[model samples]
Target: MKGPLFYSKILLFGEYGIIKDSKGLSIPYSFYNGALKNDGNASEAALNSNQSLKRFASYLKDIDQDLVRFDIDKLTDDVNAGMYFDSSIPQGYGVGSSGALVAAIYDQYAFDKITVLENLTREKLLKLKQIFSAMESFFHGKSSGLDPLNSYLSIPILINSKDNIEATGIPAQQSDGKGAVFLIDSGIIGETAPMVSLFMENMKQEGFRNMLKNQFIKHTDACVDDFLKGDIKSLFKNTKQLSKIVLNHFKPMIPQQFHELWKKGIDTNAYYLKLCGSGGGGYILGFTEDFEKAKKALSAHKLEVVYNF
Candidate 1:
């Protein structure tokens, strides 16, 4: 038996900025997806996933029942019966693999679940974020719950700040357009906790805080607005700045081998590279007005185009 499918997500505009209340935008990436499945002859991967689910089920049991509760009995029964998350979404790649899993479990088994059909008011959305935050925290030590929310809703989400978020519509993708947003696989996993800790540690420095406020967040917010408004020129300009700031200030989060590649994009107008998620070594997000030019410039690497405009 296979449950509903939940897609992966990409934080187009915001990465580390949202923690400080920067405007953020996230879109659902239909390229990779996950689902809950119970297979008769569980493969090794399925067995491994089932074991993880057993532990996750135990964690859910102790979660705040006031916010949300699950059919722990049935969930456990399924787990014991070899239920597993059959997913193509890669973990630790910053594409919301765990978020998809959380969304699928919530969709399949949660009691008094919030249906996507209901009028999603600010209060309701906020409540969903809070519940998702709590539920997803079992995977990440801390979570904003945005990933699961985006995957569950299967739409673009605009993050105004820490307290305000809403479902938003982005400009239509031009199938034949030259400009594109793509992913460069680092081909290595990235850990969220360490990268986040490094950011927090950097927060203690006065100069770092100043730069984050004056440059990093400013560019990120502008990129969000530009993308939403469909101002391609302005979006590219701001994204260039954002990419540079990430390379200069958030160096540790970026993988070592890609450092020069990231810089090359900024130096030339061919493309702009930014952190996909925590960015130790997952998928590096790339934006370019001419996909052909960007691909030629970095022909050694593999590129997966997610959006075109």
Candidate 2:
């Protein structure tokens, strides 16, 4: 038995800012994806996924019926029958690995689930976000559910704020364009819970809270707006500001080795680096007006371009 595939997601503009009700832009990353399959063999990876699914099934059964209803019995039976998630999405990469898993489960097991084919009204989008948040919280202590939502709908999601979101169309990618948005591998896995916890701790400081509201969120919102409107100049400008703010404030979230590299982008104007997700060590996002220049500057590291403009 196999279910349809769900793609990974990239929260392009908002990472930590969204937690504070900042505007966010997320797009599907089709380069990595996952699906559920029953191989009837207990390979180590499959068994591990099956065990995780078992725990997830139990958690789903405990959710309030008014919130979401799932076929818990069927989920359990499938796990027992060696059903596991067959995925290539890397965990701890901030690319929505667990989110794809959640989306797949919700798609397969949720009773009366909102099909992606339906006309997704604002109300339906919010409901899906709420349900996904509740379901994904089992993995992360708290969640916005944006990752799973992006993966499930396979479209760009624009979050005006926590309560307001919609499907959005981004600027068309230009194949011949020199500007690009890319990902740099940190080669270290990051756990979401700890990074999130650290962010929460930092939120307690009045100075940090002020910085988040005044600087971080403001730039993020602008970046989102500029990207959607196809304002390349303003998008790059705001992205540079946002990158600087992240470097100054989100230090711990940035892996130590990349600190100079992050700053060099700002200094050289070759590219701007920012957190991809809950960054401790995962993929750091890079934006450059000239892809060739940025590639030349960071020749030592592995870079994967996500979009071109």
Name the runs in model 1 displaced over 4 angstroms: none
The lDDT for every candidate, in the order shown, is 0.93, 0.94
TM-score of 2: 0.99
- Over 167-275, each residue of candidate 1 has an lDDT whose tens digit, in order, gives 9999999999999999999989999989999999999999999999999999999999999999999999999999999999999999999999999999888999999
Taking all chains together, the TM-score of candidate 1 against the true structure is 0.99
Task: After superposing candidate 2 on the true structure, give the runs of residues whose Cα lies further than 4 Å from its correct spot.
Answer: none
Predicted structure with the largest lDDT when compared to the true one: 2
How do the predictions measure up, each by TM-score?
0.99, 0.99
Candidate 2 lDDT over residue span 33-99, tens digit each: 9999997866899899989988989999899899899999898998888899989999999999999
